[model samples]
Target chain A: MATRDELLACLAQFRDRCNADAQLRPMLADWERTILIRASDLPAEHLLIVRGGQVYLEPAAADGADLTVIAESGLLADLFAGRITPTEPYLNGSLRVLGTEEDIMRLDFISLMIWGE
Target chain B: MRYVVSVSLGSSKRDHEVTAAFLGEDFCIKRQGTDGDLARAEELIRELDGKVDAIGLGGIDVYLYAGGERYALRDGLRLLACAKLTPVVDGSGLKNTLERQAVRYLEEEEKLIGPGTKVLLVSAVDRFGMAEALAAAGCDLVCGDLMFAAGIPYPIRGLEELTRMAKKLLPEMTKMPFHMLYPTGKKQEEKAVTAAKFAQFFDEAAVIAGDFHFIRRYSPPRLDGKIILTNTVTAADVEELRAQGVKWLVTTTPELGGRSFGTNVLEAVMVTLLGKRWDEITAQDYTALLARLQLKPRIERLN
Candidate 1:
């Protein structure tokens, strides 16, 4: 289980990785969305707003985000770390992701660009 | 300094574009699809012939090889008739020539798919060049074309049968919509979560090979400790496959900006770079260019 600060750091790492990867930059060109991350064990402070080729951490989850992902802190860490896909946990109930197909695909693209197989 | 455009009867959603270097020269390559519209495809080839250096006919096969037998499709004939100034091919040239080399590169040279590997090739009809190459490499191949592509319950055994059947079916298939022949465009866009459907195949094989879209549309569950030997994977697809515990994702084509392409684009690339009329080119020329292009599968290892 990672600390709140560590989780915040993961979000930053994702943004930086996307910026550095030339292959990933093109996929992120049109990826402008508000993603809310809600961990069961942590408070609702981990909010990320993606726009203009960057992801920004917000103080609170936006009123109506383009995508909302809910999971426990440890599972959220696993999702961010590329240890597990959202589909696995989403099916098993460890994670719940709410978004249109496009929204989830956009986030998945970001996740792949950051840590790939 | 050359431009290569593909006139495809496929969908734009799956088509791709890239700018890359080959043999120390730079070129711009694009695949434009009519989404199964024949009139539009004809118009596209006519418009692009003079402007572009080469064109790849996509979605429909111009020719299929089965034990030295060439089965040409009527649809391909129509597309070929529309082109005059630029060299146009259906990527079969590369599929028949370089794909054999690529499979060898993966097994003996690159050692990506090693011997004793149990490979599940989705459909050899679409890529018989690769199918024949994999067979020649002595791989334990399981053909899924019948089950996966044709929606039949049986599995094909060898290259000869794959070629014979494709020769018989491809012409009839061309009469149907492009999406019906192979999943693409709106047909492929699904939100299904049925990993159980293809989990059996993923579990049995060391590598699931063939057209990525065909393999992906079936919704293969996470292939932890396994490999996906295919092409045209996006960044999002990698993320999903990684989460599924895929140890390696060996795309058959080199990618640009996280999007890999099919052989048609590369064949068009070959035409643009060679700067020769299509009829004048020969197998010898393709063999020489294969060494020159230096194009190989874009390998991604997760574990």
Candidate 2:
């Protein structure tokens, strides 16, 4: 069983991985919008994406935000770990897009870049 | 035609009798072993050899596997699997490990269905536990039901709340999870609303409730797509839904002890109607589906 802190650290690592990849440069432009991950029995929160030039952490939700990416923590871990396929959660309802479909699709591509299949 | 199988580790005739009464004549009640023993369990499963529609393993430790194989018990009956008989360990790492292992077994051994299948995982505790396990196991569209205290006591409200209260009352006390709880009269109504809400999120949704009244309250939205109902839904309810053009209908309550036991009949019904085997689905699939449906778990754990 992974602790909540451990799970949060894993998400941070995933964000770092996305920053190190150069091919993902194009999608980094729209990373400012908030990305909220809701999982387990916890509440939803903004995921902070720290960026320095092209190197960036994907934009997550702040105290208040326009976009939220809700999913079970385990699902997020699996998505980041490559145990399951990307876009699988959104399509299946495990990963829900509470924003507009377009915003959701944009984030979907970003997620693909971060997680890479 | 509903098929049922009761998987047990011991000759707990009471357990067999109870399961048989709930599942009816088409069901198989096989004895396995007690405690952490699987030798007899394996023998019983071998005898099943495709004769059963679904297998219900009595309360046994799912984590105590002798070799490479793990045991899979009925969905939502985690109390029996851990045999803790108290709520203190409900959210403990041990239970989580067992849930993950059970889900893994289901994924590796259970069969699959077409694109139309709907899977629901009902948890009396944190909805995320089952959701996370299922997702890790590769199930895509699993949904979950959270049990709540609908102002009732005993079997209706589920024992989770009392456990939480006990934890507060006895800060340093160790706790065991109990399965018995009070029933929520509004469970069916509340679940129906939940189903309708979930219909918007997933292509399919499975709403698990204790009684037929819940199914009756499940009036489909004006949306274009079709939704399936299961479990305690009777022949009359099926006729009603069919009249309304519900394309799929299946019953699974008999498999979960029976409709009388208030197990997740809707889940079984959805599995059968969608032609999905238990192993092919995971809690993540159901959680994701519910998330998409915007279907909140009925129960809320107090911090």
Candidate 3:
């Protein structure tokens, strides 16, 4: 199992690498929504958001978050590594969604990000 | 007996669909209301009564919707109506209900097999809770998992090797034949080749081919008085096997999510049907004894 800190580091690396792309830069710049990532071992207040030119990570709930993704940390790695799919995990009970389809579909970039190879 | 049971419940979001698979025929069994009403589901179940040996409930939501406030009573009656009622559980309140009822049924019903009977378990994936239940039931268990060589990838030739290894390893015990279970939407030919290899390893083997090609192409050189062939046997299959002087078929009910066999129900049903008296016989006698009694049809429902 990857630790919370390791996961955060991986996410940060992904953000840094992807942000360098000219096309990706515009998307990140305008990515102004709050996203709550609920993991089993982590505190519920661990929030990630992008506001203006800065990325924020703090122990506070982001108000009016656009999406909440619920899954175990290991599953997140598998999803990010292209070992499985969002639908597969959800059908197999490894992933659960409490939000609308739009909220879930917002993360469609995940497939491209992890499995572009 | 051919059963056409329908599982009906209240929740629309819940997965109440029934997955029925027999030899050469597998289909989704569901009750769609004309106006999406719950009564139609109930009527379907009533229509299927006394026709099928089992009516499998696919998920927890279906149970709640079907039983309503009186879900417990309805659930019990549902179990009694069919020879078997398999309720799928996936970390919900419904699982708790099924667990409670299953324990009671085991206590009241006769054990499926006699004490110390040896049984074999084979699967291509993880065998969760099955080995434990067999142990608890006092079965002398011999189990094996499929192994793939490095770089071989999924659906490898390991199933055949695994069967051979099992036969070699379990020389003293009677092998309960082999069954191949594949995921939905995957082709059965790959699995058939594996099953054929398994049958080749032993004289008397049963191959469960989910696809048509598998059912047709799988033919091992006749070991004559040694091997008996079955292609995805149903209730009718069991009757045919019994008529052919073959007895003691080892099978299990499908578990939730359609991955593995249901340990709780299989254990309870096995104990209730087989009894615990055969546990005392020697390995040789046990094998001979099993070859005499016709066993029940192994049923598995899709998630």
Scored by lDDT, the top model is: 1
lDDT of each: 0.70, 0.38, 0.35
Q: Answer with 1 or 2, whichever has the higher lDDT.
A: 1
Q: Docking category for candidate 1?
A: incorrect
B217-277 in candidate 2: lDDT tens per residue?
4345421223332233334445555565544343322233422211222233223333444
What tens-digit string does per-residue lDDT give for candidate 3 at A1-117? 667776565455544545444433333443465666677655533455656534465544647567666778767656544555565566566777555443343343333433332
DockQ, candidate 3, comes to 0.03
> TM-scores for chain B, in order?
0.87, 0.30, 0.30
- Model 3 chain B poorest ten-residue lDDT run: B172-181
Ten residues in a row with the worst lDDT in model 2 chain B? B171-180
Quote model 1's TM-score.
0.65
| Interface DockQ of each model | 0.01, 0.01, 0.03
- Model number with the top DockQ: 3
lDDT of 3 at A54: 46
**Candidate 3 lDDT, B1-303, residue by residue in tens:** 123222423223322334544333444444222223334444554555555433433211211111112112233234334432332211122122232232222323524333464433333122223333444555444332321101011121223343433332222111111111111112222333334544433333322211112232333433222112112233443443345444333333233233222222222222222324212323343223223322232332211
* Winner by DockQ between candidate 3 and candidate 1: 3
